[model samples]
Target: MEEIALHILDLVQNCVEAGASEVSIAITECRRDNLLTVKISDNGRGMDQATLAAVTDPFFTTRSTRKVGLGIPLLKAAAEQCNGSFTIESSEGKGTQVVASFALDHIDRAPLGSMADTLAAVFAVHHVDVHYRHEVDGKVFMLDSKEIRQLCGDELMHPRVIVWLRAYIEEHEKQVGGEQ
Candidate 1:
């Protein structure tokens, strides 16, 4: 993934495909510590220990439609190369959690990317509930699909809703990310 947001999207997609009904994504940037952390958790049919052990292998995939799973491997490599760490924990019939940390200001670290767009894209398609939290320095921004659903009903996939969502998220991204 070119951007960290894309990685988040890919991981969220994986969660959806794994029968997840709920997903959580958290991005924290600690400039003082020079650390950027991304944690994604999903309530889905998780992998067994054996599958989890092999997930880091790019060529080892459970999907029959594809021969390789590059998302996890690529993300792992991206973090490791940036003097960071990556870990994934899963339990069969439970859920999965992936955490990756990177050197925040590392020259090789990819940009965080357009989170608003990425999230809007997800909302425009999948109906899975998502809780997204992003923090930069000490500022924070949060979005909960369940809350939005309660207000807008289940028709959140509509174009207008998605447009509004994108703008809303974008504005918050700017504010919380300190772009303003």
Candidate 2:
């Protein structure tokens, strides 16, 4: 994947495949600490110890459609290239959490990309529920699809909702980044 957004998409796909009804994605960028951290958690059918152990192997994948599974491996590599760390934890019938950290200023650290759009895209496309919280420094912006669905009825996917989300995220990003 050329961007971290793609990696996030891949990981979310995995969560869906695991039968997750809800997923949570959190991103933290701390310039003072010189770190960018991405964490994804899903209430899905998580892997056992054996599968977890091999998830980082490029040669291992549960999908029969492809011989190489590089989602986890690639994310790990991206973090490592930036002098950071990647960790995956899961349990059968429970859930999984993938946390990756990268050096904030590393030339190799992929751009954060339009994370607000990424979250909105996922929510708009998937019927599954999700709770997304994005925090930069001490400020926080949260989106809960289920809540939106309750308030908007069938209009959760309405164009206005998407537009609102996109704009809300953009505004929050600006607030956190300070008009950079």
Candidate 3:
């Protein structure tokens, strides 16, 4: 993918397909170390060893909706191109965790595109709880829908909150990203 956010979207979609009710996404950008890492964990029906091993294969997919699987394979290629790595671990009854890391300064490293927009898109539509934490250098930005629900009460789904989140994400994208 051209942008890391698109990769994130595809990975999270896998979580949803696995019957996840809770997903956690963490992005840590260490500019000084020239590293960018993304970790996505989900409390969903996980995979067997065989399935996990084949997850990176373009020809292997558990879904009947499509004949090919390019998400994980494409992501793997992207990371490797940047002198990075991709790893996935899971337990059948427990959950799954996917980690992808890239060399920040590598010429082939893909852009970590509007990440805030990616988070907002995942949160607004899923209805399920997601814990999102972004760390740029040492600074952190956190969004917990459960917390929002607690504060907003029955109005948790209010259109205003969604709009506010979208605006907040867009406005402070650079700040949250440590670009400024």
RMSD vs true structure, all candidates: 1.3, 2.0, 1.9
Clashes of each: 0, 0, 0
Comparing 2 and 3 on lDDT, the stronger one: 3
* Local distance difference test scores for all models: 0.92, 0.83, 0.84
State in Å the error of residue 141, model 1.
0.3
Better candidate by lDDT, 1 or 3? 1
lDDT of 3 at 42: 96
- TM-score quality measure for candidate 2: 0.90
Query: Using Cα atoms with residue i matched to residue i, what is each candidate's TM-score against the true structure?
Result: 0.97, 0.90, 0.91
Full ranking by lDDT: 1, 3, 2
Residues 1-180 of candidate 3 have per-residue lDDT tens digits of: 779988998899899989999989898999898898989999999999999999999999887989888888998899888999999999997999999999998998878887767777776677667888888989888878788778876665566777787777766666766532
RMSD of 2: 2.0
Give the C-alpha lDDT of model 1: 0.92
Per-residue lDDT of candidate 2, residues 71-171 (tens digit)? 89999999999999999999889899999998888998788777677777776777678777767676777778788788877776777888887777777
Off by over 4 Å in 3: 153-160
Point out the worst 10-residue segment of candidate 2 by lDDT: 171-180
Per-residue error (Å), model 1, residue 78: 0.7
